[model samples]
Target: MATASAVAAPPGEPVAAPAPVPELDLDRYLGTWYQLAAVPQHFNLACARDTRATYALDPQGNISVYNRCTTWANTVNDITGTATINDRETGAQLHVSFPGVPTQDRLDGPTNYIVTALGPDYSWALVTDPSRISGFVLSREPALDAQQWNRIRAAIETAGQNTCSYLTSPTTGGRGDIAPLCST
Candidate 1:
C-alpha cells in the first residue's frame, strides 16, 4: 500500500475546499487521460506502461469507463467500468464498478470516488474519495511539460497529499529515458 504524511488541518474543522462543483460538464471531461501518477492500489498491479483511461456518457445516466495499460509481458490489458454520480448536489462525487460483475445489486455499495480538483479546461484532474482511500493524477497526454507538472504537484500538496508516496508507472523501453513515470 502507498503511504504519505497526513497534511495538517485544524482539529475538528473541515478543510475548506478550493472551489464548488458547478454542473459536471461530462462532455468536457470526456476523452483519454494518461495516468501521470497515482497512489498505488491493487487493481492496477499488472500495468507496466502507457496507462490511460477513456470516458464517455452512457445513455443510462452513467459514465462509461475504459482503462487500458501495457503489461510486463508486453501485452495490453483493458477493463471496463461504469460510474454514477454519488451526490447529485455536487455531481463531483461518484461510484465506479467494474464490468457490471456483481450485477446491479451492489452498485451503490463501497465503490467510492470523488473529483478533488479539475483544471479549467479539463486537461488535468486530481481525484480522491471521501475516505481518502484512493487518489490519482490524470492528464490529457502521456507526459506533461515542466510547467504543467509543477502546477499539478502544487495542487496535490494543497490537497494534503504526500507526494513521496506516488507510485509512477514504468514507461515502455522505446525511449532510452527512464524518466519517473510520474512525479509530484
Candidate 2:
C-alpha cells in the first residue's frame, strides 16, 4: 500500500522529499500553536521560553503569521509574516514570507512550509521545509505527554528526519528535562 512518495530507499541512499499531508483545512489550522520542539534556527536563537505562533486569515485571503517568544533577556520578540498556499489541491504546501527578516522572505519561490503530519483532531502537527533543513513540532497545548512525544518522534522518522536535531522548546508547563526530541 506504499505510494511512490512513501517508498523507502536502499540502505545508505538518500530518501525522497518529504510528503505533505493529503489535505489541510485552513480554518482548522488557523490558531495558536505552541512550539514543542524544533530544529535550531538562527532566528529562534534568542528564544528562551513560550515560543508560539498564531495564524489568521488576512484580508487578501493569505494566512497571517504571528510568531512570538520570550527572549533570554526577558523581552518579548514578535514578528509578523504571511503565508500563501502553493498547492491549492492539498493546501498543505505553502510559501511563507517575513518582511525585513534575513533570508526568510521567499514567497516567489517554491513552497517551503509543508505540513508533513497532523493529529487527527488538529491538536498537533509536524512542519518542515522542502529541503528538510528546518522542522517544528507544534501542538495546541504547551506540552505533550510521553505518548504524544512518541507519536511525534514516529512522525519525524516517517518524514526522513533525524529526531536528534529537534531540541525541546521551553514552555511554562513543559517538561522539566528539556532535551532532543529523540530523548524526550
Clashes of each: 0, 0
25 Cα displacement, candidate 2 (Å)? 1.1
TM-score of 1: 0.78
lDDT per residue (tens digit) for residues 27-145 in model 1? 78888888877777777778777788899988887888899998879899998888887777777777888854554335565436667677777888877766555567788866666
RMSD of 1: 4.4
Where in model 1 is the C-alpha error above 4 Å? 1-23, 100-105, 171-184
Worst 10 residues of 1 by lDDT: 172-181
Q: Best lDDT goes to which candidate?
A: 2
Local lDDT at 22 for model 1: 58
Q: Write the per-residue lDDT of candidate 2 for residues 1-184, one digit (tens) a residue.
A: 1234554678898776688999998899999999989999998999988999999999999999999999989999999999999998999999899988767676555788999999989999999987788999999998787777788888888887888889999898875445887665
Top candidate, metric TM-score: 2
